[model samples]
Target: MADLQDDPDTALIAVGGLDDPGPSPDKAPKTRPESGAQTLEQARELLAAHPIADGYSGVAQALRESVLYDLEAGEGLLETDIPRLRDGGVGAQFWSLHVPLELTGDRAVAASLEQLDLVRSLVESWPEGLRLALGADDLADARNCGRIACVLGPVAGPALGDSLGTLRAYYALGVRSVTIAGTRWTQRTGLTPFGHQVVREMNRLGMLVDLSGCTPETMRRTLVVTNAPAVISHHPTPVPDDVLRQLRANGGVCMVACTESSIREAADRLDHVRTTAGPQSTALTGAYDTGTPHAPGLGDVSCFPRLISELLTRGWSEPDIAALTWSNVARVLRDADFVARATKSRRPPSVARLLPPLDA
Candidate 1:
């Protein structure tokens, strides 16, 4: 098995669930009486035009571990719920089909599949609030229907169990993005040949390549091998300036996490990224339930409007905020699909041989 070196601090964060089945995002406006209340209302209006498309989340793991949480009312201790996400103006979320590093082989595969099932079930249970986003176009449809589009991905590269077939199976099952989330890939340095094969296969399958928590070396290597846009699902921090330049060149967006800490703190991080790499290279990730150290103020999914309001107060224009919150992710997803269609016409599915698993 290959491990994906992680740099979560600079990784592009990606996704979770929304609904209305027998279990989803629309309602009247919120009238919070906090300070700077007027700017907050403006920010909410802007988000109404360009709602958020959060790139990553680990809430599925949290959800899996807990049995008492409710998705609609958010009655328990979960970081996200339908009202909060809608209040946050979230239009899409990428639920992570996470397979823990501690699990390997069939166990990892089972975990991945179970998480995938869990995400789908969440969407199915609340079709009015959450819709499974199978493609980039689905986001707009989800928004039109007043539902949060739920996308899927697995940061654990080993979740495929060293099998290209499993990758395809995941794609078929709504896993649209993949990251090298392991740490000891094949007991080798950087991505293995099979790993490169995995990247190409994902490209061929029209899936986005995630670089969340990947080291610069691994990130560079993956960048070289992948043609479709790759994202850095960062924990709301900027990467090295040079890597930022390379990522910009690749037309990839660095997903700045918003649900990590105080609105002012997250704003500072977003401001740094926007200044360092320009707004075109930025997107928002809720960073909910990612298990990173948490802080007070603006920490839940419902707080995105407040984050946007802070940016507005800082002289960040509405268009730039829209790009950060929505358009960048939409463009990345569209580009990946376009590249896959053209690439698939020229190449067949990968048939690479999986190497023997190495001891951890």
Candidate 2:
């Protein structure tokens, strides 16, 4: 609840969802136009009229390093999805290596590795249009070269097993960010002693701590402990005022999701709810059962343009929108990368001390 009224600069605008990479146009299911088609059409018109300038090449140099966070495109993403991102002016995206919370221990680690392999393979397949970005400088380089930069992020703390060594190994394998507590609150409560240790380790490794699926307590505590800026990659709006202020103070970001559910909530057409059952249940049910018309899913990257238009309609200035979309998050990435490079010789903390006691 950073005041959007008196402090226009602090309004946390909800951006679009993680890229979904839906079926290719040829394979897409046929359907009638939906309710927001007109709005979407208008948005496209605006984008065409005011295309997002290519960083350095366009009017907005600050936007050159723009990134799309929390993209859960997983293994289903295809060669076809690349063009959609390029056309939307997205220079970089953080592809989520999301292992389901149900798959713990070795299974979780294996699933995560497989997902990472898939993302690397996909980038290799489209080398001309895509490149694997390990740090912020890589993202900027990709933008300069006109390629879509892809970064790796693992969702949930369990994916690292009980070892901080495994976490460092993940960084060695190319993961730059981590969702500390996934959609469920299982591993360690954010306020707990063990959770603070995890946050500290993540900071030492230069890994971005994503709070997208964390509980309120977890988010608040993580903010207090994290040395680098955290991100609520895809969250609902009308976020509590206190949380907003805290996020700003920590220099974190809450990327407003552009999915049907998040859009409805931001528009005051739906109510927000906390899900206890995890991602599958939340995906099946949504923020609220308001029966609101479904907006286009993440597969259609066109949603970015529509979101931009929507923000403009609400009187958001160009600079504010640019900062939310690119500048702020880019700053976090840059700082994290600098730390990762500087701490090349630092040893990771012991796994025994990092994990909490079974009974505790």
Candidate 3:
């Protein structure tokens, strides 16, 4: 493990969540604020306004397949948010079962379960618009059926305690991914010996190991050990060059987050990295920091259309944009799901501990 403090360039970006008051009762407006009513008409009139060779339909199709898999959105999303997600062209969303860094042991596990229950309840309430997706196939089915596939993921590994059994239990409970570290570095530093074991177990269990919150050194090391491709659910500040290189080699995806600071910082850096790493190694996410005054009105799922437009303006080809918006993350999800199914029967029960008894 490298000493992160010794390198100023490796410093992580500060990320804090506001107390989400949950979604409002009001329905989302029919049109986006950025584009206005005229822009809405333009989208509807795409075929009439543009020549078929202009590729307007291609961009429109890409948006329809776009999946906001890593929302990091907790219990704040109300029933009304469902329609907003659909309107945003989000085919699927992984609502993060984020356990606070302050939680540990049994409390962490309990909190995670509660978050899961909340998401399930929300999906149940809106059966027409939302479906609980357990795997990549479910997501595809939901998209084909014109429904949003909602999935669950834990934001930190501590939610599993130190028990491999607890980890398997999460998988059984429909948690397809686990962020190895939370937002705080203390929870999972680069040198933490246990982090390596966690990655290996996650690989064996066919769970996605998310390195979004991990320190650069930790992310790099985990990438080296993980057989399955990992996802950086949210991009960190001062992006690590080596991690980008490893991600491309390992066939993982780095999701560029949608926070004011994240977007500003990632703009120049991501462009440079993509030139060498290839677009397949990168994806975009709406890590919507709800309830935060710092980033007012920027957390909406609707921001994705604007992002797509921006990518087009930046000279990103249709295929590259599609890969960033849909296929790359889709591939990772499918791969993880396949591994989980293959390893399910071999998974040991909680009592079949990974470590010997402390007393022994």
- lDDT per model vs. reference: 0.74, 0.51, 0.55
Expressed as tens digits, the lDDT of each residue in 213-290 for candidate 3 is 677877876766665677777544645777787777666777765555543344445466566556766666665432
Off by over 4 Å in 3: 1-80, 182-194, 261-270, 289-299, 340-360
lDDT of 1: 0.74
Model 2: per-residue Cα lDDT at residue 190: 49
Which residue pairs in candidate 2 have backbone atoms (N, alpha carbon, C) closer than 3 angstroms, thus clashing?
1-240, 1-241, 14-256, 15-256, 16-258, 17-258
Which tens-of-lDDT digit does each residue in 111-174 have in candidate 1?
Answer: 8888888878878988878898988789888999899998887447778777889889988888
- Which has the better TM-score: candidate 2, or candidate 3? 3
Better candidate number, 2 or 3, judged by lDDT:
3
Tens digits of lDDT, candidate 2, 97-206: 76556898789888888777766766786688878887767876777787777777744577877566788899888887777765222334545555565666776777
TM per candidate comes to 0.85, 0.67, 0.71
Error of 3 at 138 (Å): 1.0
